[model samples]
Target: MSKKLIAIASTGGHYVQLSRIMKQANFDSNDILYVRTKVNANDTPSFENESLIEDVSRDTLIRSPIIAFQMLKLILKHKPKWIITTGAMPGLISIVIGRLLLRKTMWVDSIANTKQLSASGRIAKKIAHKTLTQWPDLVGENVQYKGRVI
Candidate 1:
């Protein structure tokens, strides 16, 4: 059977937050496919079912389409029942595609965003089924505070 969930995030803080959430959520690693950015040689597989895609951001708008296509293919290939992410551009892209495919989607704003939601998190508030912030003060009608991941 296809994986039950797709959990994605970019490198650094985003990936760290995703990892902590995964552990706390107590999901079976075998049932989730982890998607993260291809940062450097130091990056190694953290889970048996995982894939890495090129990292792109607002500064690299020209390549966003490529990242989106990659996410689409990844999502289609896995056919996950749900998609959850800790944000950066990659995770936001995955949520969008996951939603279009009718997959349940959730976005957790990085804990690094203490004062406000990140750009991707803001947009995700509109696209994802649930948008969460680590800071309770940042919560709004579209976003919920789920406590800190760090």
Candidate 2:
């Protein structure tokens, strides 16, 4: 069976950046899957396999457990070999689950976060197998500024 690649784009810009990487890498919808909010799913109709989750942020951290449950279900169902995301709560949960499952995980920090890594990305840097920053200056021991999504 082909290994599945998972990505969560919680914001509009994050979705666009993920889309760019999908196209740049010539990944078909079948080769990869998406986890996003309902609005983000509506924004990008190309990917057929998508899991829509409740959007949560640092301000709305109270909903993390619910979001985490949803992430767990996706991980159990898809069994993705690779997990990736742009900074956000649901994305953070996915990468954490991915790491626990021994899946290769990557966090591509948003280009909008030029000064520092996004909050979710910062957390993912500790758990994810690889964390990448869009800006060169923000590279750290755990987070690396390799290439950009946009």
Candidate 3:
């Protein structure tokens, strides 16, 4: 069987960043899967389209549990060798689920977060196999500042 790579991204900027990495990584389409919202899915030809909790802000906290469950299901079903994200809620949850399954998880905090880590990135620091930031100043022991998608 082919090694599977699961790339998760939310709408807008998150999608742009993840898509850029996906394009550069050049993994075969058959070995790649995307966990994204309907808004962006119309453009990327994904292998699966399960409903994950949508992009959320501080006020939309109630959706976290649902997103967690959905991510758990996806991870168990696909068992990807690597799980990557340009992130927010869903990405963080997938990292948690993916890690629980002993899968490698990477998170590239959205370019939007400059001074501080985004909500998901903060949580990712404890769990993800690797966490990347777009801004150099934000680099730390566990968090890294890798070049951005561009």
Candidate 4:
């Protein structure tokens, strides 16, 4: 059997954090896909081999069916077995779609010093196969602490 396909974050802090995890996980570079909203022309070399998708911002994320449609397309194209994220809106959409498709999904709430759980983390708890928090105390029964991604 082939190794499962994995999707990782694409931009901002989420992308940076996910990149570290992916490196540690030593996931097959070809089997990993990356999704991000902002693409800097100069940063193209960073994601040369992996599949890439633009993340839709929070304000327009769920409000637009296009975002959902795009997500569905990626899910179909990649057929990933695991979807992991760092609490971004587009990443949340991927988690939800992966769940609906019965894929294994992991959502890691961002470790930024915010007292509240992120919108992505909250929604992911309701649907994801696992909700991992960097801070053990903030997690409820539905969420688990998986140590800091950093």
lDDT (0 to 1) per candidate? 0.89, 0.80, 0.79, 0.73
lDDT of 3: 0.79
TM-score of each: 0.93, 0.88, 0.84, 0.83
Query: Once model 2 is optimally superposed onto the true structure by TM-score, how far is the C-alpha of residue 149 displaced, in angstroms?
Result: 2.3
- Kindly report which residue pairs in candidate 1 clash with one another: none
In the range 1-150, model 3's lDDT, one tens digit per residue, is: 333888888767898889899888887777777777555434543345323445555677688787778777777777789999988777887888898889999999988898899977999988999999999999997998768886
**What's the ranking of the predictions by TM-score, best on top?**
1, 2, 3, 4
Model 1 spans with C-alpha error above 4 angstroms: 41-46
Residue 148 of model 4, lDDT score: 88
> Regarding TM-score, does 1 or 2 come out ahead?
1
Question: Where's the lowest-lDDT run of ten residues in candidate 3?
Answer: 44-53
Candidate 3 has which clashing residue pairs, if any?
A: none
Taking the tens digit of each residue's C-alpha lDDT, what string does model 2 give over 1-150?
Answer: 243888787858887888787778787678677777656535554446776788888898999888888888777777788988876778888888788778898888889998888877878889998888989999998988768766
- Cα distance off (Å), candidate 4, residue 25: 1.2
CA lDDT of 119 in candidate 2?
A: 78
Question: Per-residue error at 71 for model 2, in Å?
Answer: 1.3
